[model samples]
Target: MTRRSASTGRWTGSSRCCPLKTRPVCRSQNPRSSNEPLAQGSPASCTAAVPGRERKSRQAGRPDVTKLLVLGAGGQVGWELVRSLQPLGEVVACDRRRADLSEPATLGALVADVKPAVVVNAAAYTAVDRAEQEFDLAQTVNGVAPGILAQAARSAGALFVHYSTDYVFDGSGHEPRKESAPVAPVNAYGRSKRAGEERVAAAGGDWLVLRTSWVYAARGQNFVRTMLRLAAERESLRVVDDQVGAPTSARLIADASAQLIRQALDERSRGSFGSELLHLCAAGETSWHGFAAAILEGWRELAGADSLKLRELAAIPTRDYPTPAARPLNSRLDCTRLEERYDLRLPDWRAGLMLVLAELARKD
Candidate 1:
């Protein structure tokens, strides 16, 4: 469905490609007048200015209030980012309707019109198997659009933040991969994401590329929710045991991003801000079979055993479950750089799982 902005008289494209719907603009700490509508443009814009309030000096250890633009605002991470980033400054959140990634040409205009201090892109073409048949579409949204956004951010003098995946590595070694590790993607989706990373880096300004693995949330279509649905429908299930990675929560990623953005802003104030590429995920690792088992176990604890029909959970190798794209056997990523630079400690995978399960339980 297409939507036209009342002020711009421009049509926002359909949501056929984008999975998430647009969320309302979040103005938690916004200094702007409550009745003033958001600025009309390609991606939409929100001003941070208060009509009569005087601008504060930065010398008092307080960063200047800035405007932040968040693309993919309807996504799992994007949804949380709207909430998490609200305290930082004025948040202009956009979903596919406000900012369509497939139309790369329009994206530059969106950034230019917004002229935000920070640009966070959480939207992506995440269909792994489908990407094999729709490589061009995936490449356009996941690969091409990011470069344009990064360039726009550079031109606008804004910090660009993008998320990547562990699939960039060809599942060769058993150990976790460092940010410096060589990349050789085995699937189309991975190739597109890798291409995005390369392009973002090539654009070169204040930028950050965070690589994460097995992301999930209380909402959205992810492995955790899929397992829960399947468990209630089937008596037994089979999951691949060969592939392993951390099950990072969208909430964790959002919170960490806020912290990173805050630090980046502080460093910028001190003229020490620099671009970075880091791995961000949960602390530990587990195979898909193990993750499924843990998910069921946690669900049972929260919703009781009768809530699911699942009786047996079978573990099988990757070969037994062939797909349109090959998955990385070793999806591990070493987040030492992130930890050291940010002085943050990531929680274990199970801890994150339980929190999500509890949220789901409360929803029920």
Candidate 2:
């Protein structure tokens, strides 16, 4: 365990491979425009700015320690961000309730007060289906908040770390979408997220947008929990099989984000630039049915004598699965950029699921 400072915002870590340095980034506050209109897509130069951070990360040198402030302390990603940012420096985790993202002035004030070395925004409008009807709220939270946050991070000389979704890309490509691929989101949720990405890039902030898919954790309400509950209650459970993607664990993403933030902050400490968009998810993929099967398998193996059977899972097509928002049939993110840059390895979906499953079972 790393020991963190109570007042100076300093931290002491015992990690040999990564004993991060800690310090405040800057003291300036980010300002906002009075228009209060919604920010839109990334332009040519901005959108295309996702050059590999790995390109600049080759020269290895110990970066100074930095203080980090994480927005959205309540969400799944935010929860883990709190754990991951420990070794880096003093971490101040906040959410909409703790601080206001809609009130740009408040956000700027918070940044100035925090004086963090980095800001990781894990907060967002993740209500995929509900986002269609709740466009305004979604846009406000996911789209507007990010731009505001990015500006704040940049103002504080903080490297903003962010998380995005696979929905940003309209499911039209055969291969997994790359960081540079053109995005044409079909739903309001996707549109809002894409808009957020664009705004971050356009604002010219030192940032990294990690677009992930099917994120789940034992603590939150996710697909795995839903399936397990349904399987036990109903005789048969219908799951979409046509839509395919990776089922990433919150733990995995948190760890990866930690590693990436260390590198990014290291660069910032040495006064170097870093990459913006990086895909961090598990390896391989699976349909909803496949995921259900794995969950059921976990249930049976570890589930108390009262768990459901394999016969309960009914494979269904995407058309039958109706929701307020449309999901991507191909959410396979081309992780080559991440793999090559971080030179990191990700376990398969099943492996991550198993870990989550075990955690869930322990609780159940």
By lDDT, the best candidate is: 1
What root-mean-square deviation over C-alphas does model 2 reach? 12.8
Q: TM-scores of the models, in the given order?
A: 0.85, 0.80
Model 2, runs deviating above 4 Å: 1-65, 304-306
User: What is candidate 1's CA lDDT for residue 278?
Assistant: 95
User: What is candidate 1's CA lDDT for residue 260?
Assistant: 92
Whole-model lDDT per candidate: 0.76, 0.66
* lDDT for each residue of candidate 2 in 1-364, tens digit (9 for 90 to 100): 1111211010000000000011011110111121223232111111111111222322243224345777655556667777876776666766445555544555766776666667777766665565677788778767887888889878777688778888888887568888888888888878988888888887786899899887777765556666676677666666678877888877788888888888776676577766579887788988867877888887788876467743556777767656556677888898888766765777788888888888888887
Clashing pairs in model 2? Answer: 21-65, 22-65, 22-66, 23-65, 23-66
In candidate 1, what are the lDDT values of residues 235-323, reduced to their tens digit?
88778788888888888888889889988977876789999899999899999889989999999999998999989988888777767
